[model samples]
Target: MLTIDINKQLGDLDLQVNAQIPMQGICAIFGRSGAGKTSLVNILGGLSTPDNGQLTLGATHLYHQQQKINLPPERRRIGYVFQEARLFPHYSVRGNLNYGNKDKDQVHFDTVVGLLGLTELLNRYPATLSGGEKQRVAIGRALLTRPQMLLMDEPLAALDLPRKRELIPYLLQLAKTLNLPIIYVSHSLDEILQLADSMLVLDKGKVLVNGPLHAVWDSAEMRPWLPVKEQSSLLMATITELNQKYRMSKLSLADGTYLWINGMPLPTDSKLRVRIHANHVSVCINRPTDSSIRNILSSTIAEIIHSESNDNVQVKLAFGDDHIWANITPWACDDLALKVGQAVYAQIKGVSMTESELAQSF
Candidate 1:
């Protein structure tokens, strides 16, 4: 595990954080602009010093205030990828990738090349590569350093939607294949949801919430930061069967509710996490008949949250141990008289159950 207890003052912001981040998979540092997301990662990367704190990664002590030990950036053995690619324009991709290397035995040159899909662009100059291509090369260069941990600060921020889509799969592959820990920093919820295994949310330089992605998703603290229309619940499911005739796949949820989704083919028995958006779900006093909606599960109203605008209410539904959220108008909520522990049917359309980019397979 990576332990951190640090305090720093940057201009008017007094940053303070105390949390234990897991050292396996991707741990995302998430917050809005000026939430000290970058500052915290900078401290972890040895790019900046904390006023007073202790930091330990595995058996190494990267920083200790009492002992006055602060390792230099290079000595920390942490790879960093910033918002920009930051590649050397004067050199070809191959030359830039080999610039800093003393332990060539640790990583194979061709392996890194193929992992980032840079085999075709090895001889191309930085100017000739697209934004996504340059970032891929940058990632390859970082991996070639053989760092113990990787720090990424919105690495996809500069890319357009298509470029971001193209790059996400590569990152997911890296997360699954690489044994090294990754600390990803981003303000975008979509990116965090898709890439992070655990999350550390910051608000005004303080650690608001830090824990596994699923746990944080259900926390009340996270609701305020999420857009009401974008609020959704994550469910872990397994692909049981695929209907080639309908171009849809059947997923078995933990509650034994089978949900169908239309998309690219996924391997059978592959575990996936799906997002059921609040806007796509509607509450019914009783199960409906002859409806176009494909999923209608019996659920209990566990909690109801009135929107700050007073225009809508977010109802939390419980089905077994799993929970889903539904956003309905206040009038509808009053008309139905929803209360805690009230039985209600949740209608979810098949098209509404999207294959999230954030879903992970085990």
Candidate 2:
């Protein structure tokens, strides 16, 4: 169990966070810039001291205001990777990696080196390493510490598209094997979706919303903040087959149903995600007898939300465990007779963004 009750002031922003992160997997701090996410992670990692708080992981009390307990950074045994690689300009890649070691320890040398594929670049200097390589080495150096938890403060912010793309898979693999809770700070929504099992959204030092990744999307609080159109549903599926003749993709969902899509990132043998936008989805009272839409799934009306401007309605539907949204006019809602528990057909015409746009651009 990782718990925090902290109050601190930085510049014009004030932070009062009281949250608990279960001690496993990755948890992201999400928000726009100036939301005080970095400060919270810094305080957890012992890089910054909070005005008053009790910070602890399991039985270990890292910070206690009443007890006047505050551990130093080195003693905290927490790994940190910032957005900038911050590799030493003068040191060789290997030297910069080993600089944080309390002594000459060989415990994590080979495994860490191999995990990041740093063996080929150990002899190279930071100036010669690519952006991705430097970040990999930075992560390797942090992992070599064998810390209790990891603090990643927007590590991909400075990297280009290719660099970010190159690092995500490795980070996923690293997270799976780390066996420790990770405090990830990120401003990108897609980054949180891809890497985080859960997230906490911050706004001006206050926790706007925090829970499972989908919880942030489900809450009414997100209705105004989210771009009206970009909001969509996340559906997990297996690539059942490739329709080479028809130039389409087929995905098999867990609910014993198959959906045909344009194209996906997965190989025919792999699993991947498919996005269905509510605005792009049309509802029908019956399975259309003469419809061009290839993907039609059974759904029920769960909720009807009006547009922020009150010009249209956003219809929410339940399909098995997954939910999808649709943007329709008030007249259309009445015409279709949409209501909770009414059987309906979710017609999928040509999607807004194809399979490629379903996720974040690399």
TM-score of each: 0.95, 0.90
- With candidate 2 superimposed using the best TM-score fit, by how many Å does residue 318's alpha carbon deviate from the native? 0.9
Q: Write the per-residue lDDT of candidate 2 for residues 1-362, one digit (tens) a residue.
A: 78888999898999999888877778999888898998998899898999998999888889999999999899988999988888899999888888876555675687778878899998899999888898998898888777888899999998998788788877877878667578889988667667776788788899888777656655667655667676666666777788787767777777866678775556675666556666788888888887878778888888887776887788787877877777778889888777878888888774453644343211
For candidate 1, write residues 190-279 as lDDT tens digits: 887778888999999999999998888758898867788767787888889888887788888887887788764577888887878888
Q: How much is the lDDT of residue 57 in candidate 2?
A: 81
State residue 74's C-alpha deviation in candidate 2, in Å: 1.2
lDDT of 2 at 262: 74
The residue pairs that clash in candidate 1, if any, are 194-358
CA lDDT of every candidate: 0.87, 0.79
What's the distance in Å from true for residue 9, model 2?
A: 2.3
The stretch of ten residues in a row with the least summed lDDT in candidate 2 is 353-362
Question: Runs in model 1 with CA error above 4 Å?
Answer: none
TM-score result, candidate 2: 0.90
